[model samples]
Target chain A: MGVKSTASNNATIFCNSKRFFRKLKEQKYLYMMVIPGIIWMLIFNYIPMYGIIIAFKDYNIISSFFEAPWAGLKHFSDFFKDDWFPIIMKNTVGISLLKLVFGFPLPIIFALFLNEIRNSTFKRTVQTISYLPHFLSWVVLGGIMITWLSESGMINELLVNMGILDKPVAFLGEPKYFWWIATISDIWKGLGWNSIIYLAAISGVDVELYESAIVDGAGRFRRMWSITLPSISGTIAILFILAVSGLLNSNFDQILVLRNSLNASSSEVIDIFVYRMGIQSARFSYATAVGLFKSVIALMLLLLANWVTRKLTGKSLF
Target chain B: MRRKFLARRTKGEVVFDIVNTIIMIVICFMMLYPVWYTLVNSLNDGTDAMLGGIYWWPRVFSLDSYKAVFADSKIFRAFGVSFFRTIIGTVVHVFFTSMVAYGLSKRYLMGRKYFMAMGTVTLFFSGGLIPTFLLYRSLGLLDRFVVYIIPAMFNFYNLLIFQAFFREIPDALEESAKIDGANDFYIFFKIIIPLSKPVLATIALFTGVYHWNDYFAGVIFINNPDLQPIQTFLYRVIAETTSVHMLQNMPAGIRTTSVTSHTIRLATMIVTTAPVICVYPFLQKYFVKGMLLGSIKG
Candidate 1:
């Protein structure tokens, strides 16, 4: 019996190997098509992984990577001990939370409101105009915002004219107002564009559900509340999961352009911090450690969010 | 009673329509006001713009800003660089992304699951900016146009959308092509390519917009001013508002002499954004459809 079983297992292994080789030969062209992509990824994505070792070493441009002496945990400790660490953390988390609270819901609300409009023309116009800002680079938009918010700019002039204030408020120059302004500007830029997904999801909701509700004496509001919202609940959940995953991402480009020395206290996020320290200061190792730290945290949060969604809602990002 | 109910319903509908129109118009103004402000301000006389006199209309309309922008040889060169880079970068990005996406779309493809897992891992985790910079440097790609194209070639999300679209194509098409002894490449180009025009067009527009608007990569990778794209050039104009040297060699008495320092900033912005805005309307239908299709699902 043992000899027979051994022979059967060996035969199975041989068969699998033969099938694999045959499959490889048959799909050789497909494999060839994937070569450039794989090579690009390996060169640009994978090779950079070796540089992560610099986080542990006292890396310097003059010394070879291998010759750089290891200083395990020193960079990490230095980052934690830095005077600006808390400020940066506070700004990053503060801005992220504000975006989550304000920017996330803006699109959802806009979509819901837009869904109620019966006029297709108006809907498309609103969508087009709203989405225009998203296409404009932050560099340009930043200039626009500065012009509008400057002491002599439109907003201040309007406010003063309305007798809302005796003097013009320096909106961008003040630290206290910077975060709020950033959040509002972000919402303004993305509200329409971000809502496109939700609108699509709303459109995907079965028309029959609305018809049945109407037959049951449901008003427009009731039908929307019961039918439209529930139909796109899955999409909302998925987007929420995605948003939670990137709780650390505060949009570096937006902040970088919007930032000034006066508002740096409120505007600096992890990405901007890493840019300033790593790229500007040339503390490559320390910056990598901080960035790696953020990426790891974000990944862990993503997995946790996915796990929780799977457990509670029976849906996962995967 | 029936007449009364019909009248009430019609009245409610009328009210809703009016309210909706008003709200939409207000939102449109809010959306467009900033852009309009920039445009009008750019065209206004420099001193008038500085005094915040121009709002809904240009106080003293002038083509000086436009002339100022075109007068500079650097702006023209940068525009050419941007156009070339966008064309090459977008084409390469779409081709590689679609090819890989097509390969991965097949269920029977070996190592599909592993490849997918690897792709997903990249979506959430990267080796950080420092490492990526070092990697690019080591490859002798830094400061090259290839640096702009290679790193961002395969956006995994876009690839997934293409893969999904390819998977939806009827299998019988490939089966019949196979029976005719058509090779995979032949089938991909001859059959699949023709069928996938919507997605191809969508990806092209999307990639084009991304590459055109990108200045971050240019700032980090390209040290030479000559190689800088339009966005980077505009960024410099904004960041260093006082530097007339950047705009030197313009037609005499064009933008350099007339536009206020602040209006110059706005003018540069308007110049950079106008091309994108012009291209948008033509592509809006496909662009929105593509975004919806790509984003609505996983």
Candidate 2:
């Protein structure tokens, strides 16, 4: 009886292997199509994962990756104890929060206002004009901003001519004002582009609800407050959750382009700091440690936000 | 009496329309003022531009900036490199993205779930820049044009968009093609490609924009000045111009003002950004449709 049972088990295993190979053959074309994508991910995404070890090593180019001496948590400790840590963290969090407060709501408000326009031509024109800024690179936008906000630039000239101040305000140079200027400019660039999604969601709202609201003698404002907002609440909630996930990311490109020595104190975020330290200074280990810290926190925030959203609204990102 | 009531209501609506028009015009000006300022100042004489002379219009208008930019051989070379890179990179990106998206859209594909999980993992958690750079170095892609294209080939968001579009394609079509003895390649090229033009166009536009605008990858990977793309060259121009401004403030012998730097920088910006901006309106219809379709699946 024992011999028979052992033989049967072997036969079953053989059958399973055969079935797997047959299925593989049936789906060969599908596999072929996915080859380039898989190869790309393996080369670009997965291969880079191996370099995370440099975060724990005293990375040196001459010594090669495998020979680099291990530093354990020394890099992390150095970053934590660094003089600029508190200031960098404060600036990053503060600027991101300011963006969250102003930039996040502006698009929603714009979408709401746009949804009121009955004429499609006017709406389309507004959208096209508004979204143009988003496509412009930070390099281009930065040059334009610098030109417009310089001492003798348009804004300062208008202010001086109107007698708003005795002299041109140093908008970009003053550290205290840099954060606000950065946040506002960021909003201006993204406001229209960001509203595209919200507008799409708003357009998907059932027209029957609006028609019924009108029959009930509801005013435009009343209908918007009642039917429109609630209908798109899911979209808002999802976007809000997604936005919260990236609370740590104060756009590096914009900050990098706009930063000068005079305003570096207020403008420098973790990304810029990482680029400066890692790439510029060649302190790979310390930069990696900082980046790792940010990534871990970001991942935690995303998971927590997703969990909370799922629990409250039964909607999760995954 | 009915005509009079209609006329009164029309009058009221006209008044409301005028108010709306004024508000919209103000918004439009606010949107366009910076661009206008940059364009006007770029064409004006550099000194006049610096002295707050160009407001809504150019003062002492000249094509000297354009002349200066054209005179720089580096600009032309950079533009050529950029153009070539954009075409190749965009094509490779679109092809791979569409293929993987189509493959993943099929429910019967083996390990589809695992592959999808891997792709999504990349969206949130990257190994950061050091790891990525080290990987590129190890692969001998450092300072190579492939560095730009390879690293950017698999955009998860674009893949998702394509996947959503592919999923919408009727399964009957594929089945019928198979029954007619057409292979997967033939089906994909003949039927799927024809049906997928809208999404393909959208992805192409997006990928093209990314290639045109990106300077960071070139800055990080390409150390050779000869290989530098237009965006990077434009950045160098701006940085050099800023440094020149600083030099101008220095004491006696150190100060050497380059009068044309400002104009040159502005002209470069126009040239670099113009192509992308010009193509945008042509693609606007696809942009909205693509965005809407992508969002629905997400």
Candidate 3:
């Protein structure tokens, strides 16, 4: 009786396997289409994920990355214990917060005012000019900025001649001004491009709202504040949550371009710290530990922000 | 009634419009002047540029900087590397990403949920820099041209963009193709792809621009100067020349050149930036449409 039941079970398993193959064969082309991408993802993305174990290991060039001896949180504890930890953490959190305060609102304000423009040509020109910088790599912009902010460059010349300064000051050379420059430049590069979403959101608001506001003798500013702002608040909430979640990134490209030894005190942030420690100096384990710490924090922040956003605004990234 | 309303403007409203227009014009000037300043400086004689009076227009109107930038053998090779990766990277990105999106867009495709979850999980979490770098090193990708194109072939965001686009094709379109005995592959190639030109162009533009602009990958993966892209090469030049003493210490080619480091910097900037800015207007409409669709749909 036991043998007979086992045979029937084997038969049923075989039948299920055949049906699975037949269904797969029916959409064989679709399967073929997706196979390469999945394979690529598996290699380039997922495989690297397993490499995260290096953070807990004493990894080096001689030893295989996976086979390296486990250090078990030694790297993580070492990073937190390091003297430069406070400086980098402060710089990262400070710059990100400043950017959140200054950079976040410029685009929204620009979009709001831009919507008031009656002339389509003027609006289009402003938009085109504004977004042009967004396309130019920071390598170009940073080079331009170096020249512009030079002691003898246009900015210094204008300030000295205007009598706003006794002499040309090296803006990039000073630590006090570095944060503002980073934040302002971030806004400058992204303001117009970022406004595209808000502008899109505003466009979807009912046209009759505007017409009725006109009937009610409401001014443009009044209509904007009462109707437009409220309409796009959902988008603002979503983006704000995403931005808060990304506060750890601090835009390595921008810092790498703009930073020098003179301003490294203020400019050195988490991502730059990782690059210097990991790629440049080849402190692989410590860098991975720092990176893993940052990733975990970022994930927590995202979840927290999403929760807060839903609680406060009835909208969330999720 | 229309004529009367057009003729009437409250004094305050008129004043507000005038103020708004003036502010807009000033903003426009502020936005344009930085790029304009760079062009003026780029065109001026390098030595004259150092004297600091040049503004609004080139003072000496010399093309020596441009000539010098072109004369550099490294710049030529860098440009070649940049162009090669951009074209190849963008094509592979659009092609495979589209295929994957097409598969996902089909409602009846098996294991779609698992496939989607696999891709989506990556958006939030990743093995950090060390792991990714080590993986590349282990795979023998470092210092090779394949480093730029391979790792970036399947952008998760672009996958969503492609999926959103593919999902929009009316069901009837695919149904008719199926009824005519065309398989999924045939319909995707002959029908969906031709109709997806706008989206494909948009994704291509994004991927192409990314390849053009990215120096971070080159910084991490490629150590050889010959394999470096234009941006990375320019970054090296900028980093080296920031200290005057360093430039003086450099091999004679840069120090002996007639062009100032400032002018050389400007020329390099223009060389790297011009192509993207020039091609921008043609891609602008599609870019906006793509951004809107991706944002709204995602």
Candidate 4:
């Protein structure tokens, strides 16, 4: 009985291996097509995942990632105890929430405003021009911003000429106004381009709803409130979830470009802090710790957003 | 078209329409004036621009700023670097991303689910900046040109886009090819790729734009000035407006006679921005298509 069972098990294993090999052979070309990308992802995407271990290690540039001495929770504890932690946290959350509140709604409002335009030519022109800034790099936009915000720039010129201001203000140099500057610049750059989805969402609304509303003597405002906003609410909800989940991001490019020593108090966020600590100061372990903290929080937010979105709208990103 | 249904207007509606049009026109002017501000200053006489009356156009129209940018050998090199990276990076990125997407789209293939998950996992998580920098350092990829191409080859979003596109290509086509004794490689290269042009174009336009605009890679990966893209060079020129670096590594003697630092700054912005802007009209449709497609579930 033992001999028979052993033979049967061996036969089963042999059959499975044969089938697996046949399957591989059948899809060999498809495998070939994707293997390079897989390998690339493994190296660029997955391998660094292993490097996340350095968050707990006293990692040195000279020392290998795994070879570094394990200093359990030292880096994280140090981050918690550091005075800059709260400041960075405050700045990151502050800027993110501000952007979420201000930046998120601007595009929606812009889309609604745009939707009201009866003239296609005018609407198209506004959209095409607005998206131009979105394509421009932070470096260029920063230069543009600096030029505009400069004492001699057009904005100051306009303000001073209009008697709205007593004197030219160095908007970029002040920490107190950095949030507003960042928020406004973000809206300026993205308002049109970000509105594209909402516009598309608005377009997908049933034409009959509007036509019927007009038949019932619904005014433009009333029809908009009844028809357009509700139809596009899904897109808005999805984008809102995405925006909220990205609350920790804090517009790294915009901040980095606009940041200066004077405004560091308001401008320094989690990403900038990580870049400074990790690259500039060579505090790899500490930076990794902070970065890990950010990623963990980001992950939690994403999951929470996805869960909430699924529960409410029956749609999710996962 | 929307106006035909309700041409009759109340005072409130008329007022709202007027306000909306005014707001749009004002916003349009605001958006445009900054680029114009930089432009007029770029073309103005360096000394004249310093006096700050050059608003509508150049006070004494001169080619000084453009000439100065052209004279800077580093700008030339940076442009060449940026141009070459955009071309090669875009091609390699589109090909590999599409190829992977094609493979992952084959749900019946063995282990395809795991492959797709491998991609989706990377979409949500990353190793952050330091570890990536350290890993690149260890791999001797820091400052290398291949660093641009390899790390960016497989974008998960592009992958899903390609997968979604490939799924729409009927299975009957592939089944017929298989019956003809043509393998998946032959089918992909000859049949699938030929039919995949629209999606390919959309991906190419976006990833190309990304490559052209990227300087964060240079900021983190490469410290060599020679290896820096035009964007990074402009970034430095903008950030360090007062430094000697603004003078294009030229001899100090030429500095006093050259364009003002501000003029040079505008010129740099123009030179960096114009390439992308030039292609915008041609590729704008593809991006709109691509972006909307992204919002839809794959």
TM-scores, all models, native as reference: 0.92, 0.92, 0.95, 0.94
Q: On residues A1-318, what C-alpha lDDT tens digit does candidate 3 reach at each position?
A: 585457557677677778678779988999999888888888878987888888999999879876899999999999999988999999999999999998898899989988877788998888887788889887777777777776777889999999999999878778788888889888888988899899899999997787777778888789889999999999999899989999998988888888888888898898999999999999999999999999999999999999999999999989
* lDDT tens digits, residue span A109-134, model 4: 88888898877899888888878888
Candidate 1 residue-wise lDDT, B1-298, digit = tens:
3344345565666787678678778878888889998899888887666677577899888777777677678878888888988899999888889998888787777888887777776666778888888777767888888888778788778888898789889999999999999988898899998999889999999899888888888777889888899888777665433223223323344444457556666777888889889988778888888887787445
Candidate RMSDs in order:
3.9, 4.7, 3.9, 3.9
After superposition, candidate 3 runs with Cα above 4 Å error: A1-15, B1-8, B244-258
The alpha-carbon lDDT assigned to residue A190 of candidate 4 equals 90
Model 2 TM-score is 0.92
Q: Which model scores highest in lDDT?
A: 3
- TM of chain B, each: 0.89, 0.88, 0.93, 0.92
lDDT string for model 2 (A97-214, tens) is 9998998888987788777765789889988888888888887887777666666567898889899978997677778988888898898889888888889889889877877666
Badly placed stretches (over 4 Å) of model 2 are A1-11, A63-66, A310-314, B1-21, B239-259
Q: Which ten residues in a row have the lowest lDDT in candidate 1 chain B?
A: B242-251
After superposing all C-alphas onto the true structure, candidate 3 shows an RMSD in angstroms of: 3.9
Alpha carbon lDDT at B34, candidate 2 = 76
Candidate 4 lDDT score at position A249: 89
Among residues 3 or more apart in sequence or in different chains, the pairs in candidate 2 whose N, CA or C atoms overlap within 3 Å are: none
- How many pairs of residues collide in each model? 1, 0, 0, 0
Residues B152-238 of candidate 4: C-alpha lDDT, one tens digit per residue: 877888888887788889999989999999998788888999998888999998898888888788787888899899888887777
| Candidate 3 vs 4: which has more lDDT | 3
Q: Which 10 residues in a row give candidate 3 chain B its minimum summed lDDT? A: B243-252
